[model samples]
Target: MKKIFIITGEYSGDMHAGRVAEILKQKNPDIEIEGIGGENLKKARAKIYCDHSKMSGFGFSIKMALDHIALEKKVADYLLNSYKPDLVLLIDYGTFNLRVAKRLKGSGIKVFHYIPPQVWASRKWRIKGIKKYVDEVLCIFPFEIEMYQKEGINVHYCGHPLIKQLPEKADREQFFAKHGLDTTRPLVSIFPGSRTIELRFLANTFIKSAKQLQKKHPEIQFCISHAPNLSDDIFDKYINGTDFKVIKGENQALLSISDSLILASGTVALEAALYQIPMIIGYKGPWILYLAYLLVRCIKKVSLPNIITGEDIVPELIQAKFNTENICYETEKNLYNKEYRIGFIKALGMVKEKLSDKYSAEEVANEIIKAL
Candidate 1:
């Protein structure tokens, strides 16, 4: 039986990796799969070597950094000497995965990277390491193919897996009734992100902003889309006494029924765009990290949807700019201004067109099998 090892660093990566694992199993039932991932991979029948929850959060402290390094080394050594997977599939988590790639460079094991890091956003210099270590790169974004190929790295543009995984739109009336939401009110969804650090930095601000907006537009109902990875207590602390509805693991339902979204600038922003929902992307982090980002970031836009279109379709407010005032201002513009909303939605249609239509999980799975 062929053995494949997968490694993912976070919740989103784990979800994408799990889909690929499921497809791979369908193609070759006898293949043995093991990985360092989360519940998603477990559901896909991949043996859990290491739960990726251990490596959560945005930036690691010194102790965390040291501990993760030790853990990664131990896992790498075990996989190399004992498990000896025929192919090592890496999904995002660039820093650790890049190191893993370098370690396995001449080990006679094929290394394939799915959803390669955002080298174009910042640290374009990492292209050297990627070119040297990664045998083949399966990219989800169309623009990423040119960037990787320009550097002479073997790469393929598989359509975004999210396109396939995107949930069907629920009946708005039934969804509202089921959630006990006021059907007459315009709904606004809020996505603060899945990571603990992200919620810690932005959840309170999001709540405060929503309250401000509510005072102005009393008929607008607010809903917070809670990530499954986070405990209810974390979100409860922010919206405890507020009127906002906390919707857990129902991003599609929430996005589908909402008029606009106030979201953290990441994959969720792109997901919101996919739904054709107008959104204001907001982000905040440790000041030092923010400063470092400003210094290193090569791109002007931070949101994936805006980056893909090469235009500011949705407004972005980061760091000091990501305050309650700015959030309300942007949300108000999207909600009340019919002309602006229509133009933004039209631009999003073009953004969707730029992404490939190939089923990413199947394409990636086929490539992995061929490599094996």
Candidate 2:
């Protein structure tokens, strides 16, 4: 039997890894797969070496750094000594995965990186490290190929996974009725984000904005999306006194039915764009951390729809501008301005055309199978 080891460090990464595992298992039942992930990978039948909870976090902390360093050594030691897998797949959670790749360098084990770092977005210098460690780069964005080619790195432009993974628009009537929401009112959704740090920075601001927006537009029905990766207690603390319907486990469906959205900048922006939902992105953090980000960030825009189209299709409120007032104002435009909302939706539609139609996980699976 062939052996493969995979590593992922967050909910989205684990989900992506799970999709790849599902395809890999279908292709070759004899293949044995194991990984560091959560429920998604477990459902896909891969053995869990370690849960990604320990690996998930947003910023620098001494304890987090030490924990990850210890994890890297443990994972590398196991792969090199006991597991001795034929191929190792590294999903995102870029920093941790890169460190693992560096440790596994020159081990004669093929290391394939799917959904590699966004070097084009920031820290372009990391491509040097990618070149040194990873054997093949299965990058998601079309623009990433040139950078890799320039570096003389082996590369494949696998169409973005979201393109194929996103489900068809949910039945709005059914969704609204199921949630006890009135079909007569325009539904607006708020996605604070999946990370605890994000909830800390944006949740209250988002809730306050929703309250204000509701006061102004009494006809609008609002719901807050609770990212499933978050524990109930961790999420509840953020929503304590806020009284809107809290939607959990139906995020994509909620996105499909929403007339507008207030979101924290991340992959969810792209997911909303894919659904062609008009939204405004708001994200802020500690002043020091924001400054650090500004120093490294290569792109002027943060929302994925704008980044993919190279135009500001969605309004972004970063740092100083990410306030309750701005969020309400932008979200209001998305909800009430017919002409502006139409144009925004049009631009979002173009994003799908710019991406490849190939099934991303399937391609990754086929390539790995061929290599094995």
Candidate 3:
């Protein structure tokens, strides 16, 4: 039996890696897959080396950072001495996976990177590390191929996994009734973020923004696309007295029916574009961290829809600009301005077209099999 090792760090990365695992298994029944990932990969039947739930965070403290470094080293030692897999697949989670790549360097083990590090986003210097360590890179975006190839890295544009994963739209009336939402009013969805750190910084702001928008347009109904990993108390702390309905595990269905959305910048922005939902993207962090990020960020725009289209198709309010007033203004524009909303939605079609219709997971699996 052929053995393959995969590594991913966050929820989105785990989800993408799981799809690839499913495709790989279907193509070759004798293959054995193991990985350091989350529940999604576990469900796909990849033997878990380490559950990523304990591994995810942004800007870790001294002790946490040291612990993660130790953990990465432990996994690397295990893979090198015991597992000795035929192929190593590294998905996102740039910092840890890049270190793993370094450890496996020149071991004659094929290292295939799915959704490789966003070196183009920032830290362009990491491309050198990627080129030196990874054997091949499977990219999701069309433009990423040229960027990686320019640095002489072998790369393939596998389109986006979300293209296949986007769920069908639910019946509007039934969806509203089932969620106990107001059917008569225009609906606005809020996606604060999936991480606890993100919620800590932005959830109260989202609630305040929603309340402000509701006061102005009393006929507008507010709801939250809550992440399943987070506790209900996290949301209740901010929305206890508010009328916002928290919808769990139904992001696509909610996006399909929303009139507009107030969201944090992440993969959900791309999903909003896929659903053609008019939205305002917002992000906030500690002042010191925001300052440091602004200093290093190479791109002007943060939202995925805007980055994909290479234009500001949707409004982004980040750092100091991410206030309740700005959120309300943008949401109001998306909800009330027909021309603005229509134009934005039309631009999203071009963004969707750029993603193409290729089955990303299957294509990635084919590459892995050929490499093996």
Candidate 4:
């Protein structure tokens, strides 16, 4: 039986890979799955070598590492030599997977990447390394294909997998009732991000923004939704003085009812897009990382909503722009301007056009089976 190695990092990457693996299994059940992923992928029958708890990010300290980096390398080497997968389906974690790709290059195992690295962002030169290591790059955004093709590497646009999981209709009333929110008021959702580092940086920004927003529209309700991985204390500390509702595992539901969303750019921007919610994007990383962003000369736009739309459809309050006043100004503009809100809705329609009609999981699975 042909074996496939699935590699992923973090909860989101594992979730993305799990959906694809589910689709692939339906396409060809005979093929076996083996590699590193979270519980979601393991539940899908992919043998779990290691979860993302070990290889989280470059920011993770040496003491925090669950196992030595060499241990992960040894595991990859062992898998390559033993199962000899026909293909390695690499999800978003480029750090470790890229290393594995380099180590196993020319071994005859085709490397298929599900999520393209931020080549459009600073590391545009990384495409050379990616093309050298990866056999095929499957990207979620239409714009990324153009960026990669420009570099002489043609990438497949698989359409965003998030579209498949996006709810057709959100229970606005139920969500409000469950969260003890007043259904009558216009809601503004705040997503600082899933990481502690990000929450720490942007929490004050989000709070300051929301506080300023309250001055303009006292009736407008502010809600801060927490990612499943984070604790309430983190968000509570930030939103303390303000009358903000603390919610968990209800990002979609929060967006559904939101008149406008203020988020730290990344995956949440995409979520806002899927929900057709108008948003102001914000970000404040370390000074060095911010400098690196400029040094690398990434795409002019950082938010996914802006990137996918091929225009600055939503206002991005990043780095220097991530202030309470700026965020509130953008939030109020989107909330009160009928023309602006309508334009955002129109942009969302254009975005939906670029996505696949079929379920993402099913489509991803069929692609995996074809490779086998």
Q: For model 2, state the Cα shift of residue 62 in Å.
A: 1.1
TM-score of candidate 1 versus the correct structure, residues matched by position: 0.97
Count of residue pairs whose backbone atoms collide, per candidate:
0, 0, 0, 4
- Candidate with top TM-score is 2
| lDDT score for residue 222 of model 4 | 87
* Predicted candidate 4 versus true structure: per-residue lDDT over 61-175, tens digit per residue: 6754544468557866786778788888888877677878888888899888888687776777888889899888888776677777877774777777788787665788887
Decoy 4 TM-score against native: 0.90
Clashing pairs in 2: none
Q: How high is the CA lDDT of each candidate model?
A: 0.87, 0.90, 0.87, 0.78
Residue-level lDDT of model 3, residues 255-303, one tens digit each, is: 8888888898999899889988898999999888888877777888898
Highest lDDT scorer = 2
Candidate 2 local lDDT, 59-168, one digit each (tens): 47887788779989999999999999999999987888899999988888999999999988888789889999999999898988888999999998889999999999
lDDT of 1 by residue, 194-284 (tens): 8778888998899999999999889999888888887778666655667677898788778877889999888888778888889999999
TM-score of 2: 0.98
Ranking by lDDT: 2, 1, 3, 4
In terms of lDDT, model 4 sits at 0.78
Stretches of candidate 4 off by over 4 Å are: 57-68, 146-154, 231-243, 356-358
